[model samples]
Target: MRRPSLLALTLLFGTSIGLAQTTVETIAEGLEHPWALAFLPDGEALVTERPGRLLRVDPQTGGRTVISGTPSVDDRGQGGLLDIELHPEFADNRLVYLTWAGECDGGNATHLGRGRLDGDRLADFETLFVAEPCVRSMKHYGSRIVFDRDGYLFMTTGDRGERDRAQDLADHNGSVLRLHDDGSIPADNPFMERSDVQPAIFSFGHRNPQGAAIHPDTGALWIHEHGPRGGDEINRPRPGANFGWPETTYGREYWGPEIGPDTLAGTIPPIHHWTPSIAPSGMAFYTGSAFPDWHGDLFIGALAGVHLAHLRLNDGHVIDEERLLTDRGRRIRAVETGPDGGIHLLTDHVNGELLRLAPAAR
Candidate 1:
């Protein structure tokens, strides 16, 4: 095996922030458009390739083994195997959940499923939820999975390029969904009693949310979505709230026309937004002690911007922002905090790389 490359540098924020010496190590390379990552109990990780392969990766050696039993996926456009997550009680149940673009009657839709991890393969894989009214469009499959503190699973769905569907409560597109671990709807779901809405919907009116993470302190779900020309946003989705996609956004059409008012009377406003579009992807809240200054900060992978965004938050509001890996120019796809307190990132490319950011030796 070849030795991994290491780059040592110091990341200095503004004058008030502390300068931290950091070292970036290439853990693995040649990953084919890796999308999401989940670490196992033994420090190995599961990575999902957009083309429908699941790989168990050894971070130390950069070796990978393809795990069998992944569901067939629609790999055209932006659709394919997406997010992977371990069950909250994974140590006991060994259950793994996944979100992917699966074939449907009309075209394809984002689907959620789970199976027990049985050595190198998944056993008894089952589909739990499918975003309804699947359409032909392959863009905007906003699929990210996270589990709340109480053990309920939360998943996001893009509008599939149909902006109107986001405003329709009957459609599953462009919404955050909540479900029990077994794929059943919870009784306290915001739309349970509403005959006109999808009962699993927790929030709606989102465009294309590709990143989601739970707040380290509040345990609230935080998600970010793409905008057309500008207006990418980070929002803390609330039950029964409308996020206002086409009807209300700070973005303009690709051809240069305003979508709508940035705010409306009834929709929930974003806590933070970006104009000119960073094209944010996977997200994580830094709770590790390796980088004390980054603890409690939010990290977002930026695809279009080609960097990792570090956001300092105060009471749910973003106060400062910094960009990491800007010199590397990699299209960051996923961001995760390793068990050892290092930050792990997956770059998006045909021959992508898995990189880790840790404190440099003094």
Candidate 2:
């Protein structure tokens, strides 16, 4: 097989790898704290604003139209619209799932909802599940969602400011939950037979997991979580695993004191960790042709670094890392791959922008 020339590759792909013209462009701006983005099969974009509205964007012109039927949100601290995901059979089902913070039993909690998408509205919507003992605090409402190969959903819940709750088996706080698509517990789940453990608990002793994705090759789950002051970690999540937080961590307290042990027994160490806190929010493994050289590499959106960080993976070890779009200085919230084989991102803050990162035009 003949390898295509740079110009030929550029012609084959929409964006060229030329140095003269940069390919990263800001498509939409002035978003109210954009949290997550899900691309439709037809190439349009569905983005969630942390303040509770969902907006759909025309891929051709970047025209944004707000979709109605969003639930009332608390929109406080770190709460509100968190993550949006499409059903595996979205093309035929028109089904989408969302995580949001809302009032539950007179307190705020993370809730999941499902709906069918109509023209510019959500129809036949229903709440799938709501967290129990709705915690009042807005911080640490871990709400990232991912699906396994068997189509089971994994939802991460934070400690809700109660640190000790992370190690408790009865509380759903600080746990990775596994459930069926329709909000039913699976019989084969890790904690299904344990009386003390909730059937929904897949793993325990976690601290605010915000980013999670399944590995393309091994099908293992990869998660990144934020720690207090420092000790941001990238971990390979395992069933019924204990990821020590509040007991063993590499982070210090916000007041400049040590929180606990630097490292302890039985707690899994991170594959990689950041010290000063990149505040990573979104992560993806590149498998697109647009950046062939970036294939199999991990890309993470850095909210505190105000840039996108790429890590080159070699046999499970991060051998190289790079930072891109540093000058733009936006709090990158989410990173996803587009249908056209391009990289897409959502920025945080009121005037957040939707950005597309691709090879520069040749």
Candidate 3:
């Protein structure tokens, strides 16, 4: 039964003192600034509403439906409608992939789409990838959209707030894209025979990479970014690696100072960092078993540290940091894992909620 010490299980999982034994279940609510959620192999769920709607929910009775075509996003600040997925064959290819905020020239960027759901809509929805030199600033749009183990499709761009164009590899914003699940460009990307890069660059400076996971036992491709008021990172991009944002920061400059050189010779630090900033969003890595001591652990989704950032890996580092839902003050935007293993969460305000976390029945 031994397995404690990670700061004594992070101060005994303190978040209202380890959720007073846990139970918080509010599976669905009005949702407005939702942004990303996936799980539909009949379990019913597929939400994403950063003001551009696209739901289907019904996590056992909360009920919902909208979803029609979607796309045409660009909902300003922090941009809209981001990250969602479901096609790892998706029970015979019903597809469904996303990552929004695209308007181009006069504004927004970071796009990538795919469709074929047919009931709540989204039938021929195309538009595969559009992150580029399109800066009108709504904020960095680095997204999240996994799908590897040969299915390809990586995605995550941001650095759109300029910051030296994340060391500019001729564009694709801050990079981490490796397409080819229909969005093309994966002819062995690592800068595809470089003629000055951008052939779906797979790893670049990156500065706003909202979470993206897939390392249940080393499947690789892990991420988490959004520093500034203080560096918040976590990496493993590797494929032509370069992660150094603003030159190699451990973070600074939200009116502060120090930004380049906490370590930079070629760049590639951060296996985990989070100084005063924890605005992380959407992530998962708990292998399931209904939280068998949180299986593999790693759960970020902390909009400015509002909470739910648990960590605790050992071989790959990040050894312990609990913090769940601090009494449900709510801000966690998207975090998934359900097929019954439970642990849904997705609350990013304007009246949003989707929670689930189990083990409270007594």
TM-score of each: 0.97, 0.92, 0.35
Candidate 2 lDDT, 1-362, residue by residue in tens: 11122111121221223332336766777789999888998888999999899999875667899988777888999999888888878888888899988888778888888889998988888888886668879888888888878888888888888888788888888888888988888898888888988778888788888888887787778888888888888888778888888798888888999988877799877888888888888888887788776677788999898988878788888876767778778899898878777788999988888777766654
**Model 1 segments beyond 4 Å from truth?**
1-16
Q: Write the per-residue lDDT of candidate 1 for residues 1-362, one digit (tens) a residue.
A: 43535334565444125666677888888899999999999989899999999999898788899999889999899999999999999999999999999999969999999999999999999999998988898889999999999998999999999899999999999999999998889999999998999999999999999999999999899999998899999999999999999899989999998989989989998889999999999999998889777778999999999999989999889998988889888999999999888999999999988888888777
Q: Which ten residues in a row have the lowest lDDT in candidate 1?
A: 7-16
Name every residue pair that clashes in candidate 2: 16-360
lDDT of 2 at 122: 83
> How well does candidate 3 match the true structure, expressed as C-alpha RMSD?
17.1
- Candidate 2 stretches with Cα past 4 Å from truth are 1-22
Where is model 3 more than 4 Å wrong at Cα? Answer: 1-12, 17-19, 23-36, 39-43, 47-82, 85-111, 114-116, 120-122, 132-142, 145-165, 175-208, 212-246, 251-260, 263-272, 275-356
What digit string (tens of lDDT, one per residue) describes model 3 on residues 1-362?
21121111111244322444655677777789897899887887888888789888887776788989978888878888888897889778798988888887776788989998988798999988787777888888888889988889898988878788877899888878888888989777877887987788888898888888889888998988898877889898989889889888788898888877778888889988888897898889977686687787889888877888888888899877878767667789878888888788888998898877766545
Pick the TM-score winner. Answer: 1
By descending lDDT, how would the candidates be arranged? 1, 3, 2
Q: Is candidate 1 or candidate 3 better by lDDT?
A: 1
Better of 1 and 2 by lDDT: 1
Look at candidate 2 and tell me the lDDT of residue 228.
80
Which residue pairs show collisions in model 3? Answer: 142-157, 279-304
Worst 10 residues of 2 by lDDT: 2-11
